[model samples]
Target: MRTRFAPSPTGPLHLGHAYSVLLAHDMAQAAGGTFLLRIEDIDQSRARPEWEALIYEDLRWLGLDWEAPVMRQSERLPAYRAALETLWSRGLLYPCSCTRRDIQDAVSAPQEGAEPSVGPDGLVYPGTCRPEAPPQGPMPDRAVLRLDMARALSVLDAPLRHEETGRGPGGETGQIAIPGDSLLRAAGDVVLARRDMGTSYHLSVVVDDAEQRVSHVVRGEDLFEATPIHVLLQRLLGFTSPIYHHHRLIRDAAGKRLAKRDDARAIRTYRDEGLTPADIRAKVGL
Candidate 1:
């Protein structure tokens, strides 16, 4: 059994992050499985050397250790490109030049009194750049790429499903069946590549999990809605879907979810205030 705690080094490690890491690590250790750490530094624009270093420090301070030679997403660009190339060859991907404003305008253009539907990626894309026919030439170099959700589903030989070892926000559990029609209407054409990063979260995450040979995916329930997207990508890329465990999130006093911007709850701040690792565990109700 292999589990990973993947965190983006764009900000300080907060209590929310600490709870996730600790839970994942404890679960792996109890089952005698390998626990791995991954640095999701694909967003080079926001990733910082100091924050990366601080992540290491904070993890160590929490009295936990992971496998040697951690994986970094920035070094796996070639693999992501290869996966994109495969999808492109199969006519499952298309170039999208529509910006957020363009999508907003298109979504609002629907009939009056129609409230735009929101997807996991915030405001479902209206498919402005979707081609009526799949392009034949090589994939575009500079334009963002989106998966044709309808076409992708129609090509599937079998129904898509995933094992949910943990409960979803709505208390969904057991073997979850992915309804294709729901995904088509809800997710729309999701992005695979961005102009700045060359790869988006959904694309990189599935590829990374498969490459890492992760058997179980332990993450926040906030990502539970996006699991179907990952499972779809896994099937398209011919990768095995890992067992998903979407744990509860660590929220604030006002019942709001924590964010990276909340430095007051950062582990670094707590450490500076003389909190011990056990103290952290008790604080988070471990």
Candidate 2:
């Protein structure tokens, strides 16, 4: 029942973030399980020290308590490198040199009702790097590393399953079992590591969660689609799968999901405007 709230220090925490943190903390507390916090500051270009400091202050002001000495991903580059090396040795990874335009052109050119599979960031790569021979030598400049989706699927001996218990957007509590095919098709050949930062979200998150021995992952439902990719990576990397709970997202009056760019919804702005933690909780209907 252990759960964690891993936040990146790219921007100020927002109402959307508060919902996720409070949800994870509440679930852990109710089950008498440990609560942990991990700083997902892998995007060095965008991550800032001041933003990270604000994360701590905001979460503390919310009356949330996490295990001391928080885990920081910036300090764990070696671990991610080890994972990339393992995947490379197994031939599960290939270096990609295609830019965004190249991928879009491939996807748009006569695919016949091909419904694109969106990643967590909402981009569906069109497998431009799925070549017959794996590239040799050092990775290409500005090259990205993509997982061999077809090969990964072949190794999956059986369908994976995860149980989730929560109220749907309609407000009915129920359980659902996720199927393997649905996950595999939607998570087609996701990027494991990118040359820009040397690692992508999928690779770093799965590795960190396993290293921390997280028992449960509770977050916004938008990420539910990416769970299968994480699960597949876990199986490949020899890590145990943690239970998942994808809760509802906190949206604005226009029904759009709140983001860091929504300065009006930023947690710090709310705090400055004299909004209490209880006020945030009630606003999000948590």
Best by TM-score: 1
The superposed Cα distance between candidate 2 and the true structure at residue 112, in angstroms, equals 4.3
Clashing pairs in 1: none
Q: Report the Cα lDDT for candidate 1.
A: 0.92
Write one digit per residue (lDDT tens) for candidate 1, span 100-206. Answer: 89888888985778889898999999888889988889888867999999899989999999999888999988999999988987788999999888899999999
TM, every model: 0.98, 0.90
Model 1: C-alpha RMSD to truth?
A: 0.9
Poorest lDDT segment (10 consecutive residues) of candidate 2? 167-176
Q: Residues 68-109, candidate 2, lDDT per residue (tens digit)?
A: 889998888889888988887777778777888887777778
Flag regions of model 1 displaced more than 4 Å. none
Q: Which ten residues in a row have the lowest lDDT in candidate 1?
A: 108-117
